[model samples]
Target chain A: MLFKGIAASHGIAIGPAFLLKVEELRHARRTLIDSSESEEEILRFRDAIISVKHDLENIADSMGDVVEGRQILEFLLLLLQDPTIKKEVENKIRCDKVNAEYAVSSTLLDVMDKFNIMKDPYIRERVADVKDVGRRIIEKLTGTEKDALNNLKQPVVLVARDLDPSETAGLKPGQVLAFVTDMGGKTSHTTILARALGIPAVVGLQKITVEIHPQDLIIVDGIHGCVIVNPTEKELSYYAEIREQFQEAESLLQQANPGPALTEDGVRYELAANIELPHEVEMVKSLAADGIGLFRTEFLRLIQEKGENEEDHFDIYNKMALDMLPKPVIIRTYDMGGDKFRTGLNSAREANPFLGYRAVRIGLDRPEEFSIQLRAILRASIHGNIKLMFPMVTHVEQLRSLLDLIKLVKNDLRVKAIPFDENMQVGIMVETPATVIALDLMLPYVDFVSIGTNDLTQYTLAVDRGNPKVAYLYDSFHPAVLRQIDTVVRLCHAQQKWVGVCGSMAANPLAVPLLIGFGVDELSVAPSLIPDVKKMIAVVTTHAAREMAEKSLSIETGLRVRALVHSYVIGKYPEILLDENDWKTGG
Target chain B: MIEKKITVPNKLGIHARPAALIVRAAVEFDCDVWVESPADKVNAKSIMGVMTLAASGGTLITVSAQGDQEETAVETVVEVIRSGFGEEMI
Candidate 1:
């Protein structure tokens, strides 16, 4: 059997599936007599609740000062003590004469259903908390729970519906070979934890937990976002050979540590990782990414609260800065609003949200909101290398105001006796054609510019990449977008302002050459793509890349440019680019 | 019952940490405390209830409690929001 999923972490793990079964509380209404049995069942339920409380208390106590762990336990404790739930359960037991477990489960399900109807993801996710505590109570009442994964006899490919943070905390690389989940995105807790732990993982398999039996032989190809189960001898040997070679290549890449990724002409280039979370600093450091090219600060808002406070942002930023000490971390301020407000924050439902107020627009309009982020980044810069970048910047004047706001924030920080890097380099994303046209006027405002080609392509071609009809037209390789990037890079270089690219184009195997040829000082790719991109850069010379760039620019369509550049790359290194199609499918 | 309407000032607006802190505070008083948004009301002492509120920054919520310490309960919660849950969020 074979299954495909979202590639989360990179590597291969061949091991037996260790199913982490979620003990879902099945609510089969148990009939209770209105006399002695009812009273006894209620007593039993009380005992179970007491036991659950004790369990949570123990867990909480064990965690000590671990904030998230303690918070979860505290929530569970509150749930157990919630008067409404207790009243609902008692009412069901008394009025309907149902068993204690049934009453508890049914009442919990009612709340879960209520939460389910909510359109807000934050509210919807609360259903999981209800379910978790419900399951705990049910487990106590029924006494039919599986042992925790910590009891596993050997290292195995952990398969689950979704590994919660607690479950993920228990999994060590020595105990768990890999993680495969039925549901999760690349940034899910399981995936993030796996990446930080250097464990290969594949998520969003949909039903891997249902199909996979305990101890079944499985091959988790994290690089491909697929898993093969109970493979035939031929398939097994083929994969086994690939796995061995992969290990060899991994160590070779690690050993090759060719610092700075210089071309044959000794032109040094910085390769950084585009990180969404601070936890990914581990992967970034291990992969030898020169720094974090793009830190999606929007995730900081999503994971915590909508427009999370400066303290939370500061703590995360400070830790990341210290963790990657001396390695530059370019934090992009909330590139949210428009179609991608995950928290259902309607920044006004405009028909054309893509062109609507977001990013630097939000910053310019809400300086009060933007100042907090600016202050946090500024304060965090004292720890280590931290560069701040604004996103969706289209106008030079707006860029000027945003920079001026940062200056005010710095003055405010000083007045308050807060120490920060007085000269933290601020930059703006060159993704809009307006910025491209105003390149000469824009270069002097900041230290550096990172061309976010993903948006630049969308805005340049006037096509939504998500729209299937015109999605094909959304190409970073398009002559105009490339020329825009080309213009920005040239003008930035001419002005002595270093330019990096943190977009899909940075990691695209074909676009890599053109980006290099265009004299992009830095390439900030997805952390997983770092090694492969490094390998591609190792053999190719600046002269060859420049020639590829010049030729591809002369080409008309993105398709032709892609074909030309990829052919040049393929011709340069035939062995490495193999199975490029079979790699992870999406973001 | 003592009741007062206060704005959620913290940027995250009653997320996990705030919810936990609120729950902790709500339980400290001898009151049947409840928090009401425009649409619905939930027990202030319940973490799940507070989280389910899904109150983002600048949303208004009314705190009501009925007990001997109802006055204190409402005031303490109001203070927590005012204090930005012990952080300089405001």
Candidate 2:
């Protein structure tokens, strides 16, 4: 049998299955003839709570001083001791004559229901924490809980309905051959942990746990997002070869050149990183990135209370600048609105939020709010090299007003006698067809431009990538999108301004050559992909890339264009396309 | 009994961390502590009760306590919430 899932991590694993089953606590309710039985039930509930508390304490102690681990454990421990939950659970046991497990589960249901209806999205998310605490108590009551993964006698393809953080925390590298889950997406904790451990994983399988027996032979093909249970001998031999090639690729990538990416013909291209949090600067530095090409400021919403204050922005930006000194840090001002941050007026009612009031529009309308960020960025400019950019600018008028706002912010700093970089570079994101056509007018006022290809594709094709019905139409490699990119590059080069592609397209191994061929000065990608992208850049020559881009430009369809690029890349670097994970099978 | 009205200073309002901080302080005194949002009131010693209060940033709440050291209990609990749970105030 074959099961398809999301290719969360890249690799393959073939081993007997190890199902991490979540024990269900099914208890029968019994009526108490005397008050003694009620007292006994209440005591049993207290004992379970105490045991769970010890379990949590042991876990927390093992975690040491990691702030997030400590905070999570602290929340769980507090929930375990919450007086309201304790009182309600005891009341149910005594009044309704239900077993300890039922009373605890039912009472938690009421608390979670109350939290589910909360107006604040953050509070609503905490319902998971409530559920987690309840599960621990029930497990203790039923005495059917243990870390099954910890007792693995041999490496196997671990299968589960879902692996929560607590279950995955004890996982060490090489402990399991692979992780296959019935739930999760690319950004889920399971995906993140699997990638971090360099383990092969396939998530969103829906029902792989039920299909496979306890010791069934399973082949987890994470690269293609599929799992084969009890493969034929012929299929096993074929995968064995592919697995060897993938291992060779993994080793090659490990030994890849850590220096700056330069073409064989000696042309250098800046390979930078796009980071969301301030602490991620460390990872960017470790990857030997050219600089931070895109520092998304949207994560600041988590602390929106302090986000409005100028000092809060200055402190974070100032530290980032100081740490990456000499290397340019391009901080994109708050890209709020849309699905994220619907806190403003009437955004919730918009039919087309992606095209509606968002990004620079919100920034321009609320100058008082906008200037606070501008003033902070300008003030932090002197601490280190800091470049400012605005997102979602469609016409020249928006560019003009944004430039005007920056000038006003600069003058405010001047009057206050605050030190700032007088020559800080300002750029704009060319994300829409209107911005691409008006690129000439906008380029003259800005120092540089970053093509946000993700938005450009959506806007260019008139399709929302999030909407599944027409998502197939949203392709960055379409002839129209490629032509637009060529025009933007040509326009920027004519004016001596450097252009960078800082979208998902920049990270694509196939798209790198075409972007370099277009004479794009920079390619800012995710921190993890910096090494792989840079390696690809090193193998391709400017002359060959130019030729490839020329041929790709005339290609009629995105699929054909992809095929052309694939052929060229497969010949140049077959290993780059192959998957990377452990070769657990001794070759 | 003693009571005092104070505004939640932290931008995130009384989230789990802030709720935990309030409960930790409330449990320190030998008194019955209670917090009252505009819509509801709950025992300050109960983490769930304080969290379910749903008081966001800039919300006005009343903290009250009775029994031994009632004034100290109300004042201490009120101070913790007003302190923004050590997070930066807006």
Q: Which candidate's lDDT is highest?
A: 2
**lDDT for A431 (candidate 2):** 86
- How big is the positional error of residue A59 in model 1, measured in Å on the Cα after superposition? 29
The TM-score obtained by chain A of candidate 1 when compared with the true chain A: 0.65
* Model 2 lDDT tens row, A1-587: 78887676778888888766534432333456667878887887898889999999999999987989988898888889988889998988888877677788878888999999988777788899998988888777655323546766788787877665535545655678888988765434466556545567898777777677666898888788889999999889988888888778776764576788888787878999887667678878877889999998865654555448878888999999998988999999987665444554444577777878899898888889889999989999996599999999988898899999999988888999999999999999988999999899889899999999877887898876544345446677888899999999999999999999988678676788899988889999777677788878887889989998999899888777777777777788876653221111100
| Candidate lDDT values, in order | 0.78, 0.80
> Mind giving the per-residue lDDT tens digits that candidate 1 earns over A38-139?
788777788888999999999899998898788777777888888778878888888889877779888998888878886667667767888999988887
Candidate 2 accuracy as TM-score: 0.59
Q: What are the candidates' individual DockQ scores? A: 0.26, 0.44
Chain B TM-score for the candidates in order: 0.92, 0.96
TM-score of chain B of 2: 0.96
Worst 10 residues of 2 chain B by lDDT: B81-90
